[model samples]
Each structure stands twice: as C-alpha cells, then as structure tokens.
Target: MYQKENSSWVKHADFTICDMLCLQLAFILAYWIKNGVGHPYETELYRNVAVVMIFIQLVCTFFNESFSGVLRRNMLEELKKTFEQCTLVCLLVLVYMFLMRVGSDYSRMILLVSYVFYIGFSYCSRQMLKKFLKNRRYEEGEKRSMLIVTVSSNAKNIVETIRKNNYGTYHLAGIVLMDCDKKGKTIEGIPVVAGSEDIISYIHKNWVDEVFFAVPKEITIPEQIIKDCSTMGVVIHMQLATMKSLGKNQIVEEVAGYTVLSSSIRIVTPRQMFIKRTMDIVGGLVGCLFTGIVALFLVPAIKIKSPGPAFFSQVRVGKNGRPFKIYKFRSMYMDAEERKKELMKQNNVKDGMMFKMDDDPRIIKGVGHFIRKTSLDEFPQFWNILKGDMSLVGTRPPTVDEWEKYELHHRKRLAIRPGLTGMWQVSGRSDITDFEEVVELDTKYISEWCLKLDVEILFKTVMVVFMGSGAK
Candidate 1:
C-alpha cells in the first residue's frame, strides 16, 4: 500500500497550529508594545475579548482555507488570504463586542496594532519556510528518485512526458526493462538498471523512492513485486490501460508526471478519511469497554463449557490479501478445525468457498449458542479495529484457506480493511448460503461506500442483533 505523503489531515493540522500560534503571539507582542508587561489583562472583559477573537479567527481561517496551499507556489495568494481572514476575524470580533456591550472595554488601538503585526509576521514566516523547503528540495537534493518500470519503447514516451511536465518533486533515477535482453540499454538517456526478474531485489538494495509500472496491456506485472513494494513501503504506481468504461467517480491522477487513471474504491475526501478513522478509534474504544464488561459475565461460562481459551485467534486475509490474526470469542470447540474436514461433505454453501451449517456440531454447547445468537462472539475484534487491522464497518475477512480458493475478482473484497460488522452480516449472514451472494453484497458495499452508508449499516446491524436474525 502506498502510504499517502503530506496527507491533507497532517497539512491542515500543521497550518492550524501555525496560524493559532502566530495569531496569539501577534496579539501578545502588540499588547506588550502598547501597554507594557505590567498591564497583562487590564480587565476581565479584555480576557473575554481575547478568547472571542481567537475563536473567531480560527473559525474564519478553517472555513476560508486560508492555510490550505503549498507554501512554495502560493506565497502571494496565501498572504492575501491571510489578510482577508484576519480582516474577517476582526469584523466578527467587532460585531460580537457590540452585541455583548463590551465594545468600549477593549482597546481599538490594540486591535489595529495586532492586525498589522499578524499580517506582516505571518507572511514573513511563511516566506522563510517556503525558501527553506525550496532549498531542501533543489540545493540539498531532497527530490524523490523515481524508477520507471517498462519496456524500452514505452519508457521513452514516459520519460519524455515526465520531462515535459517538469514535476519538481521527483527526479528520474533509472528504468527497469521488461525484456531481459535490454537490461543494459538506455531509453531517452535513462539507463535500464535491471530486468523485470531482478526489479524487486534491485529496489530493495537501492534508494528508489517510487516505482512506476508502465508495462504494455499484454504483459502482466507480477503480484510478488507489488507485495514486495507494499512490504518495503516503496510507493508503487501502475499505469491503467485505456478502457471504454470506468466506475463513476474514478479519479485520474498525475503520478511522477504520468497521468494514470486511479482505481481507488474509496470515494472519500481526506477530511472524510480522517473523520472515519476517528470514528473507528472512538467506536473501537467503546466497543472494547463493552467487551471487557461482557467478558466478566461470559468468560467463566465459556471456559467451563469448553475447557480451553475463551478467545480464538485465526490468520485471516486482510486488505490487499495481507494476512493478520483475527480475534473472536471462542464460539467453537477446540476440535473445530479437525471436525471441519469431516463436515466438508455436509457444507451447505453452494460453492464450498465458505462453510456454514444451521446446527454446526463444532459449536460449544450452551455458551456458544448464546453468544452466537446475541453477537457476543464478535466483541474481541474491537481490538483488531483499534489495532488498524480492521474497521468498525467493511467486508468480512476470510480465512487463509478460504482466500486461497478465491478467484481474482473475488479478492476485490480485500480492497478495504475488513470490519466487525458489514452488509453481509446485517443482510441475513446465515440465510444467505451461497458464497457468490456474499461476494455480491460485499461488492455492492465497496461500490457505493460512504460514511453515511457505514452509519446506516451500523444502525441496521443493531436492529439485526436485537432481533437475533441470522445468528445460527
């Protein structure tokens, strides 16, 4: 997985901290220059005014996106935006002061001084930072070194295109040729450093920042190379072959100056992604607390009945077929895996890709039945959510064995992190016996996914749990 660099949440947080600190510092400096240090807060009204001004300024900057641009390319524009934001903040403060009948209590001179001080200081500081970044990128050689992975003919076009774009962030490093015989060849002055077979090893040994797979449509990029890049945390961008039809909301992104159609399933903004993760963290905490309380009542009963561990941990395929151990309260006997092979003949699911039985003999007697009915068995997975291995809502993670049987298209369910509860769970998990139907529901969830849909699914899950539907 390519970890998003300079993520929006991080940028916003940085700008917010900088703006707040600068605003408060500007006001303090102005106050000290005007009234001297002895008269910090002359009146209780002054303190109230200061608080209100800070609040209003933060609100204005947030809404105006005053601090949302890249500093190097946006110095003049950002300065103007900052001035407008500060002016708006002052106007709002004046209106608020009038409404509170404290307009006379605060100094107009201080406001005028602070406004000028803030604009000048903020602009100068931003320009200094911009200069520092520019120096670091160009003078200090901080630009990311990119490797283009393709044949000689395609590599020439990609190299030309990238040079034409003049993207300053990434510098051309070399190329990886698909044809083994062209290992020592050069495409548009960039040497072919390695063949396809040695690409992964070469990347591991070198300081390559990102790799662009621009192979022809007929050539298949090996899955191992992608997995290797993901594991090593080296960013990978694959060129999308021209297609007649693409999904709604599909994005075309410029990666290392090459225009590639982004095939992301997440149709969410950066703010939305931040909010979703925050929700997952909060929900996971609450769910874990509930799980702890419930465990007090259920653990002993489960142990007494099964005479083994209260929780079961199994290796499950997670996002992008990455494996992680999934935790659940042990609802089956210790011999469950042993019994599974014998029970394969009795598998009810049409495809045998998944196993589900109405009266599974492997389930521990009373405790298993009770927990399964009420969904208490799923509580331990909140830990997984907290660990970032799972989410509060997504497709169910499949077992390693089950995943091995998956068709290429079936693996699309792993595009997002698996969830504790999802469309499949709420939509009669037990009643739907066919594995294909499960895949269909999972696919539908991915295609139409949003925060609103997650909330709706959560509500439906609550209802389903209350009704004890499909708990068999």
Candidate 2:
C-alpha cells in the first residue's frame, strides 16, 4: 500500500508569492524606464498614486476573472486577457489624471511606454514560469498520477490521450475495470488493480494523485465513488458524454445549471495542436529550402529523360475521410495512372489495399529509379504540410479506392491527420509487405505517440532515405 504525498499549503503560498513578486518586478522596471531618475519618490502624492494604480490593476484583473482557476486558463486566452486588463488599468490612470487636472504631474510618455513594456514582459514571464514548472515536474517524475476506473475501450482512449500529449500533466498509474469478465486483466500494459469495492482501500494504500472515472455516464454509483476519493484527498476527473457529442467546430459552453465539455472531432488537444503546427512551420520551411536545391539539380535530369512536368498530383483521403490533393515530384510517366491498368498483370507487388508496383513500367526511363531510391519524389509534400493537409510525421495518406475498402479498425488510422512520412517509412518500408503489419505499426505509433517519437522517426527517415535499401 503506497500513500500519496500532498504538498503543504505553505508550498503553494510560496509559489503564489513568487508569481506576484515577478509581476511586481515587471511593474517596477516599467515605472523606472518610463519615468526618468528625476521623478519624485516616497512623497505623499507619489505613494498615493502608486498604491491606487496597483490596487486598481489587481481589482480589474480579478473582475476579468483571469485567476479563476490555474488549470482552466487557456494559454493564449490568458495572454489576451492579461494584455486587455493591463491596457484598461493604464487607461483608467490616464482618466484619473485628466479629471484631477494633474495631467502635467504624470508624464503621458511614461504611462504609454510603461504600459506596453510591463504588460508584455509580465505576460511573457508568466508563460515562461509555467513552462518551467511543467518541465520541473516531468523531470522529477512528479506528474499528476491517476488511476482510471473503466473498461479497456474507455481506458485505452484516456491512456492514449495522456501518453500522446507532452504538456498534459497526467501520468496514468493504471486502470480498474468496473464490470467485465476480464476484471483482473490489464489494458495496454496498465494494470487493473481492483474492483469498485476495493477502491477506497486501494487508493489509501497506494499513492494515487487523481482518480479518473471513465465509466459511461449511465453508471449510477459514480457520485459515491467521487465522495470516497474526496475523503482521501484525491482529485476526481471524469469523462462526460457532452464532450463526446460535440463536433469539430462546436463551441464549449457552461450554462447556469449545466457544465459540458465540447471539443473538436479531430481528437487533438490544444497543446497537441500547438506543437504540431509549430513543427509543421519549422519542418516545412527547412524541407522546402532543401527541396529547392534538389529541384535545381533533379529538374534538369528529369526533363532530359522524360520531357514532361516535374511534378505529380493525386487525390488522397485526409482527416475524417475528406478528399484532398496530395503532391509529389514526378516519379512516373505522365499517363502513369492510365497505364496502371496495363501493368496490373505484371504487378510484382501483391495483396495490399494500396498500390505498390516493383519494376513499374509506368516509371520514367531514368528519374523514376533514382527518385524511388532517394525518396526525392516525396519532397514536394512539404507544401501539403504547410497547407495543413498533412504533417511532417503521420500515417501516409491512402488513395480514394484504398480508403473505401477500410474496415472499422483500419479507419482508426484516419483518427489523426495523415503525414508525409511516418513510422511506416522508417520501419523497413520495402521489406514490410504484409498489410496487417503496416497497420499494426501505424496503430502502435498512434498509441504510444509523443513529440520525441515524431522527432526520432524524422531522424531515422533521413537515414533510410540516404541508405536507399528498403524502397522498391
């Protein structure tokens, strides 16, 4: 039996003080820079104005509800609110001076300059502090550990979400099944500790930080479970049906009598979206720069051999099975798809929903052989990545015909947006012939996903592409 450790109130108080101190430092610096050394200090009038300004700013921030919950604030939204509050405070101070006929006493230049510097610096400092705390917790192995109480399907989804998101502070300790024949079994390597009856004893004995009730909303005794955990000082989280019902573009709202979690159907968290887009912009830019050099060299060679357009476009299935155009440099003849029918009998590759032809006749005389070996044909996909149609690392997009033949499990690949290069590309691309194996690799990638994995795959892809051993 492991008992969870709780941080003392003094520790929280200290951190809060640190937060306020940092904010105050920003204010002091802004004041000093905006007002020269000649400005009066410690005088009755100066002290009164300083006290009033600070009090009003804090009050306005409170009224804005900026500090409602440490966990509830969206990072970007918080920044915006902070800027707005700071701006309002500066404006109010200006109004006070005008009404009192003391406008000459306070420099307008000082007010404007300090307002900009203090607000921007304070907001940035707060964000940096948050990142520092998150990194420290991760490094200390002190993530918000949770015991999920649910069956495999529900537990699997929660586990995958936590594992995939680096910024999510949750670290799932294990799961507990409520009702099932495999009550004692584990789901995806997480142990199933005990049933409902043993939850209190188990939590008290173990160091459980949070208890996530992933059981469906239909379960009646969830409140009792929440109460039991509450007594033990463990935080409780639950999966609500309202979250599952929302569409991709729907707005989340909390009404007077109702609280619901609405989300996008794309299955991405805000942190995930931020990291993915950041990677796309950075990676896409680097890829485009390199591709430009390659194009300069390859374009001429490709033209000398085939005398056709240096690029190719094809329709592919995107997120949610939407149709989008995918791009590649021309690795085959202009009429490759049309000639595909003629090469069917000669197709050496076999038994895949997607097409893969070895020694393809549709390949151009010289460029096709080199393009497949070096994987240079796929370079143009950076444009697609930039356009938000694909990612630097994700499941390869499928053809329309191939996507149509997918089963429910196969469709899970589409749960994420497709990528230009992924686990399949680096995991012996040409050697892996079994479709099931490919799907398994893709599924595994999705389950154990992380930014680290994406980075590793990208690194390995470079090696694979250079070696040119696996591509047909």
Candidate 3:
C-alpha cells in the first residue's frame, strides 16, 4: 500500500486557486483602469475573453509544471518564473482572441496592465505563503517523528540529508547506532537515543511514526527489528544502495507473501495512475469520435482498393507481456503478413529488432500512400486505448515475434502499457535507423513520466502529425 507523497499539483492545489484569484483581481482592476471604473464581466466581449484567459492559464499551469519545486525556489527564481508564466498565458490569450476574431473588440491595454498587476500580486502572495508554511506548518507536535538506524559511520550523512531535503514533514526523534555504543552522543545535533539491544524498548517508550534502516554491508541487521517495528505499527524503510547501482525509481511491496525490492524507472503512486487513466479515458472518447469520422471516408477507399474488410486486427504484446488485439485501418493488402518475411532483408534499421522500410510494397497503391502519409491508419488504436489495453502515450507495442527476441534490458520498454503514439513516434521515427535509439527514448519516457510530461508529448504529437512526419 506504500506510495509516493502528493504530486506537486495536488500539494499546491490551494496555491493554484490563489493564482486564479490573483488573475481575477488583476483583470478587474485593469478593466476599471481602461474603461472608466467598470468591470470586465459587465461586458459580453471582455467577459468572454476573461473566461478564455482563465482556461488558458489553467492549461499553462498544469502543462508547464509551474508549481514544481516552488517551496525550494529562491525569491529571484520565483519572480522570474512567475513573470514567465504570466507572459506565456497572455500570449496564449492573444492567440485565442485572434483565432476567435474578437481581438478588435477588446482593449489590448487591459491585458498589458493585467500582466503587470498579476506579476506583483502573485510574487508577494507566494513569498508570504511559503514563509508561513516553513515557519508554522509543522511547528511543535504537527511533524511526524522518525527514528534512524544505521552504523555510526553513516549516521551523520543520513541525518544531514534527511534534515536538508524533507521540508516540514518529519522530526528526527533519535538515532540507533547498531555497530557502536553511542548512547547519549549526538550526530548532526540529533541525539543517539539507543543501542541495538534496547531498540524495541525505546520504541515502546517513545512515539515513532517511522524507522529507516540504513544498515552497512558488513553489519548483520537483526531480523527481529523489522518484525518489531511492524508489530508496533511503525512504517519501516530499508534504504538500499546508491541511485547508480539500483536505478532511480524503486518500490517495496509484498509479492506472494515475500517482501522484495523492486527497482525500475516507472515507480508510481496509485493517484498518479488514476489520473493517467482518466486522461486516457477522456482522450480515447475524443479520438474515437475522430476515428469514426475518418473511417466513413477512409474505410470505403481501403475496401475499394485492398479487397478485404476495412479494419485490421493483430495480436500485439502489451504491458508486461500481456497480449491484446490491436485494431488498425487496413492500409495493406490481405497477403501483407505473408510479404513481411520477404521485406526483412530491406529493413532500414541496423541490428533490426524492429522492422521498417521505404515504400513498402504491400501497401495499397494510392489509398495506402494517402492514409499512411496522413497517419489515418492509426485512428483505430483509439479503441484499444478505450478498452484499457493501451495508453494515449507510451512505448510502441511489438509483435509477438518481436517480443520473443527482446533482450533482458529491451524488455524494460514494456514496463508500462503500449500506446497509440509515443516518444519513438514523435521523436523522428522515420529518420531513426537504430533500434537501440527507439528503446532509449521509450526508457527515457518511462523514467520521467508525469502528467505534465504527458501533456507536452501530446502537444508534440500534434505538431509531428501536422508537419507530415507521419507514422510508419
């Protein structure tokens, strides 16, 4: 049941609300300054523009990851970032007004002045809020208490790192030096409260919300300590090796009645997974609507030219080796599968774990060129996404044969569900000739996944499609 702490957006949700209020106040004040003491909401044109501004600002905040590390940012960095976000929002507002043909009906000065006021108001509010939180949020008994268990050699470093990184979440209660008798001594100003012999007794006497075990390689950690901590209802964290050795993302979970250490580049909280699925559902519905429209035109062309059903379905490997039937518009002839073996020698990729080529002959001559160039062939994957067999953004699913040939490290791409469009598709798939390069991009996406990153990828996907860098 263990999961990551709150995401930045969830943690600073109040701050997001505060930002909206600041925008409202600043815009109202600007409207008064521009139009003799009246409000923007009173007018239809200005009121509509104001609503658009709010929507654009929310998108900017979420996609730009504006609130990330806000607590740690110094005043200058905060000021710069705040101004940049405000400016970007203003530019987007201008773009929207122009597209809607409402720019001429509005006072441009209102936007300029609103930006000015928003910068000052937001910066001051954030600084004040951060100061209050840093000073008062976890003062006295509000902070959760943590106990540390490590050898004397590693005690000071661990204590310092915890104190430095944890904002107001934890109060270091005490330390237990297993390899030495350092009772009543202090490391980084935290007292050594107990030795190994009296650890369980100390927990019984004092309140400890968590215990972190950073046992050294030479030290033999007692199995009784972990059981005792669990019995006492205290969260236990066994700190593993350096990030270089064990990878960045790590998790602890009960597997088949055994506690095991799992390391990958895609550790996630249940909340994050829920949000990702929500995005998939919303996007899937919209994509399916578009797919239905495209099928009306493209399906007839395929049937006229190719001599089979207009849809194609193949069993593709999904997340964690699960197989699912992936749907696609039938762009190739019925014997396309039989022809793939003959085309293997012509693969454009080196060390071809993946198959690709120029001017694939199995493609229906005129209709295939038009649909594949327009990426109309991929529309049916929206159904796969809706069925929960794929995501809107993830690694490309491989065929059953391709999956069987995957090396140990190459299988890491399947850590998450495959997608309709992914890092490989957007980042110059046609230009890339190395199969390893595709794996690298997918691994990078898995390691650094966030909702904001997903938004960014979707935007990039749009640009890639519009610019004629269509799917292969």
- Choose the strongest candidate by lDDT: 3
Q: Which portions of model 1 show Cα errors greater than 4 Å? A: 1-242, 254-259
Report the error of model 1 at residue 69, Å: 21
Question: Which residue pairs show backbone clashes in model 1?
Answer: none
> On a 0 to 1 TM-score scale, where does candidate 2 land against the true structure?
0.50
Q: Residues 1-472, candidate 1, lDDT per residue (tens digit)?
A: 4446565436556556666677777788888887887554566876777788778877766544566555534666877767777787778988998999887877888888888887887777767666654444453267777888987667779998876544367778889988665777687888888988898888989889899889888888889989998889988888867665655557777999997776565565666577678889999999999999999988899999989999899999999999999888999999999999999988888878988887999998999999999999999999999999999999999998899999988998888889989999888878989888898899899888877689989999999999998888
Q: Per-residue alpha-carbon lDDT of model 3 for 175-241, expressed as tens digits? A: 9999989899899999999999999999999988889999876788788988888888888987865
lDDT: worst 10-residue window of model 3 = 240-249
lDDT of each: 0.82, 0.72, 0.87
Candidate 2 lDDT, 355-377, residue by residue in tens: 67677778887778888788999
**Model number with the top TM-score:** 3
| Clash count (model 1, backbone only) | 0
When 1 and 3 are scored with lDDT, the better candidate is: 3
The order of the candidates by TM-score, greatest first, is 3, 1, 2
Top-down lDDT ranking:
3, 1, 2
